[model samples]
Target: MLNLEDLGEEGFLERLATWVKTRNPAVRISIGDDALVLRDGTVVTSDSYEEGVHFSRLYFSPEDIGFKAAAATLSDLAAMGAEPICFLLNLFAPPRCEIDFLKRLYSGMEEVCGRLGVEIAGGDSVASDKLILSCTALGKTTDPLLRSGALAGDLLYLSGFPGLSRVGQQALRRGVEGFEDAKRRHLRPQPRIALGIALRGKVSACMDVSDGISTDAGRLAKASKVKLVVEYERLPRHPELLAFAEQYGGHWDSLALNGGEDYELLFTASHDLPDCIADLPIHRIGRIEEGKGAFLEIGGELRPLLPKGWDHFSK
Candidate 1:
């Protein structure tokens, strides 16, 4: 049996990359550079996640971790209004990790992949002191939905309600009934894959809400070089948020504006919006403008949409 522990991270990655390069003819490039570009596409993005930083075992299971990793990256693909075809996952875990952990993780990943009809082509693993997941999702779109695609007079739409994860987190902190459902959402977020594919060609610029809404929306608006006028009243809200709002001086709007891990798509349709997007709630939340900067209009009040998302480097 080969002992991967004996090799350092670099050596193991090199050997693994070489193995992949030799076995898979479809692999355009493998590990060894600042980044790896595996296949061809007009749009491509890769995301990395850490254990304690992104999630906690006490709050989420291994299966949940696997599901979250895959789902999150898929959302990025969706944001571009691209249809995801395949994925590559690289895992780093300590030797002491339980064997069942890997199985459950893969099982969760397989569940989401099967639902989305995405392929798990290949991945590389290695021994490490902690768990880290790096997923590379490949997608294709004849007309890619970029953040820069939003034009003036275009309407913005969101696939679903927000604040489930936030309320779930707070509920867990307070011991509530809906906490599990909320935690599950926080753990295994589902990316709007079908809707994204369906919205392709039908919409102008598109992107997913990974960071908080206010934060992510700002990103899309900035990328498009256009101002965003979001009608906060049009935003869909969960009962938990509405309930939590009345008692706790609810920042429900803020949560909806900037809550991370929703994994839903925030897209723009310059023409008429789509007639159908299944299994997910889609609503027109705002519009695009030719100006610069993003703002939110709520109850006849307007405010700047600040970039207040999850920034690992922020102090």
Candidate 2:
């Protein structure tokens, strides 16, 4: 029997995707892309966050857990350039879980939802050995951004810094001091909802950086059937993360490239874009070309940019 460890996450998903066939014409986008885009402009996406896997009680509070879980799910909708309407949350918790803890978690979700004018429609709950939160976000967009729209010569852009979340996770895990900015980024990531909405019809393609630049860029490249050459030096790095690396001795470039869960926007455009969108600075880090796979350009050399980010079955 083929093991999940042998297939890995991408291989397993590729195999699973073959079994999924969309017959409904209303589904503009079915198995592929960030979210499902319906004919009536309704965009939907779902994600699950499990304790110990996605988060840990050592670093996350009840509020942080709920907020980050919801933000991660909503980020998918943002990738599709959709405005969120509402969300449904499914909670799986142990019987011993405190009511106060659950309430505080819901409050955190509400805080993020309120900022985007999203409502918690409703969901189901069940008792489990561990805690798991699943969120399904609904949104709408007249022009949805697809990962397959990228073309040759399009400039690649990334909003905000990467690797801060990984830095934060390390800091907390190692009991290191300072790096407050990095910790906050990992704990309460702000999804680029407005930026995605603004990118409609302007960018050639887009997606959120939930799985790190190397992995996410590869997905975009494969979907669009093009090559993405990313300049290693151009990848924006947070000052805090840089300082952390300098102090603790870690490769900032590797972390920035492979660190996942940044929840930032990674996009491509064929034309010149403004330096900032709604006051958010966007960095042009690379360009698309007629080829396949993703590459890292450094020291006048090109190297394959493999997916080293989070993979559920990579063991």
Candidate 3:
């Protein structure tokens, strides 16, 4: 019997996508990309966060947990170049959990939603053995960005620091002091909603860097049926993350390449793009080429970049 371990996350997703067919003509895009786009300009996406899997109470406050959960789900809407309208939350917690904790969690979500002009439409609550939070975000866009739109000769760009969140996660896990910037990045990720909206007619392809560049870029390349050659030396890094890596004896390059949970935007454009978009700096890291798969250009050599990012069922 084929189990989840053998299929892995991507494998299972591919198999599951095939098994579930979309017959509705209103579904313009589904089972692929960051979110599903409807013909009526409605975009929808959802994400789930479980205790001991996505976050740890040791470092995450109730507010932080709620904020991060909402941000993650909303980031998918941003990836698809949609402006978020509202979100539906589903909370599952044990009866022993305190009401104050739940209130604080909702407060965190409320703060982010208010900033983003999103509303808490409605949700369902259920009793469970562990804490679980799920969010379904809804948005609208006349023209949605897609993963399959990239073409050869397009320039690839990345926003913000890619590995800062991983550094923060490590610092919190190891009980290391300092690295406040990195920790904040992990605890509170800012979804690029404005940037996504700005990129509506400009970007050929775009996605959020949730599963590290090595994996997410590969997905983009596969979807576009092109090769993405990323210049290793050109990748932008934050000073705080570098310091954390050095102090903790971690490989900075590895973290930048494979560390996930950096909810920054990754995109490609055929035309020249501005260095900064609405004060957010964008770095030109690579280019799309006529080939297959993803590669790393480092030290005058090209190497195959595998998907070594987070996978729940990898053994």
Candidate 4:
């Protein structure tokens, strides 16, 4: 038997996807990108939040866990530029867990679903030794934006500043005070659904920055068969990230490039933005060139970026 840890998350996923693709010809989009799109125009994605792995009761409330879990699946739909229709939840917990705790979790999911105009279509509940929450979001799009559509001469853009969540997680772990914004970001992530909707016809390729730009950019580059050159100084770091670096002696650039869980949309477009794209909150950070692999340019020096983003199996 092959050890899953030896493959890492990406390698394991790629191998699994390759096997599944050979069996199912109807799969429009499979395992490589953020979500899977079917030929019938249905876009589906599922993500899970595990106890101790994704969150801890020490820093997150039941409501926060539920909300973030929903966001994880919804963010995938957003990356595909799909309109969310409904969400289905799979919850597993110890039998002794309080009913109120479960209610609070449902309340959190309801809050996010209400805001996103998505309906809770029902789900299954099972008893387990530990708390596990998983969500499956269903959506639809006429023309799904894919990560393989990028071309040379395309400009790269990010929906918003990165590293805020990383800074927030650090603040929470270190018990650092006065970074409420950062903490809130970590607790409650805002998926860029509206921005994805607006970018439907404009962008050549799109994906969410859940695994940090350093890794996700390479995924995009590999899928599109182009080279991505990101200018280090052009990366927009959150104000809280800068403050965290100043007070904690950490590198903000490192966090912005390598830290995961931002959920911001990363896309590529032509040199000139359409009038529709001009009004959206976006930052030009890089360019796509004719080549392979992703590189970072710092002070006029270019170097290939190592895969330092999140990996479930790699410690």
Candidate 5:
């Protein structure tokens, strides 16, 4: 029998996508991208976190774990420019885990759901050998944004700075001092919900930077059927990441490009961007062109820059 371990996440997704035999008329999107879209303009996404694979009690608090888990799912809705509606939380925990921890975890998710006006519908709970949590979110919109709408000559923009998540993760792992901002960023990433809503009918294509820009950018490019020429120098670097690089010994730009879990939005628009939206701190990082792949321009030299982001199978 075929096993999940044999194909890794992406490989498994690819094979399963090909095996889909039926296509539902109500399903606008399925088996790819950030979420599934219904014909009724509802967007749904789900994500899971395991005890050892995603977090550990040694570094992440129960509350933080709950918060980040919700954020990951919300980020997908944001990518589709969908408005918050409701969500379901599935919990899998060891027999010895604390009840208080579960309470705090639910409270953490409430912190975000309350702010975003999301309702906790309901979910399933079960016993397991380790703590595993999943969040499945539902959203609604009049017109949902897609990743395959970019046309050649559109300008690429980023909602916020990158690299802070990686810096934060490193700081937490090493128990570094005086990097509270970085640590906070890693512990609780804010999804660009407002920005995604603002981008409706304004951008040609949109997606969130979950698995690092280098990797996610390629996915956007391929979906849009165009080549992206990214300007490395123009990529925004957060001040916290700069400080982290100065204090430690690592290349800030390289780290930013390869780091995952940033949860910022990456999008493309025609040159005629609106003044208000363009005026935002949105950084122009690249432009789309007629081609089949993505490339990076560093110091006037153009070269292929494939994704070196996180991959479950890439050991």
Candidate 6:
């Protein structure tokens, strides 16, 4: 009954623009071959990746490397409740790196690009001591969601359960069994693209929990000038994360909150939720308060869980 090509590129956009005309009244230009479109306001974000720092070749295949790189970049756009449309890539590779390495990386990017329906508009490549990949992503949203938009009495939510990535990393490094979810999480973290796009005006504030919950929640609190309370037990910890945490030292909890690659959308809603906010397993894990007392609660007891999320330049 429905097809993408029924309208052509320009006609499809015209139809889409008509569909969202009530929300984004500013999308004056869109689709068509002769002329492009524009909006009064825009949101843009950029991210970078280095060989030894972000990932290791011994663990991540070249294709996975490219997918992760592009996914990480596009994930930021999702946090703003925007649909990723175009992205640019810049790569720096060492002389010793083989050509297959680069092509495979692009192949992985191509796979995700197909899924997102985005194009690698343009970028640059050069020689270096190590691999340095950077991406600048573009998104379309007249009303871009930000962390500062949250308010008191709002409910805090996460798009999916936590600690899967932690489990995945452990499974890969320690050969820990019973970690398929974790392994898949680590190998292919899917940013909640549909959920984010649907959130648009429905969510008060939004962000991707890349660096973990405690850290990212703290950022939301600071930005909104309010307090964030996360219920630890209510935090839908992956079914086996506790066991993995026991076997992996304190790293499991650490990874769950600060591991820096989960790529799930963390958001706040001012009132009741709707069915459109679907895709991942959404959970109402916490709430916002009037003060600056950002902390976490376990069961019924409240405690302070400092925001020590991953920061590349921190001391």
- Cα error, residue 210 of model 3, in Å, equals 0.6
- For each candidate in turn, the TM-score is 0.82, 0.98, 0.98, 0.95, 0.94, 0.83
Clashes of each: 7, 0, 0, 0, 0, 4
The true-versus-predicted C-alpha distance at residue 84 of model 1, in Å, is: 2.3
What lDDT tens digits, residue by residue, belong to model 6 across residues 1-315? 756545443235447756754445554533211112246545566788998777777778999888888888888778776777888998898989899988999888888877999888889988899999988877777766677778999998888767677678767877667778777788778867788888888888888887778767877787788988987766776766767777667655566676657888888998867533665678887899899857888777878877666655444
CA lDDT, candidate 3, residue 24: 96
Instruction: Report residue 297 deviation for candidate 3 (angstroms).
Output: 0.6
Error of 5 at 312 (Å): 1.5
Give the deviation of candidate 5 from the true structure as CA RMSD: 2.1
- Of 1 and 3, the candidate ahead on TM-score is 3
Error of 2 at 71 (Å): 0.7
Query: What is candidate 3's lDDT per residue for 90-209, written digit by digit as tens?
Result: 989999999999999999999899999999999999999999998899999999999999999999999898898999999899998898988999999999999999999999999999
Prediction RMSDs, each to the true structure: 8.5, 0.9, 0.8, 1.8, 2.1, 12.1
lDDT of 4 at 153: 93
TM-score of 4: 0.95
Model 6 misplacement above 4 A? 1-39, 249-254, 274-276
Per-candidate Cα lDDT values, in order, are 0.74, 0.92, 0.93, 0.88, 0.86, 0.75
**Model 4 spans with C-alpha error above 4 angstroms:** 23-26, 274-280
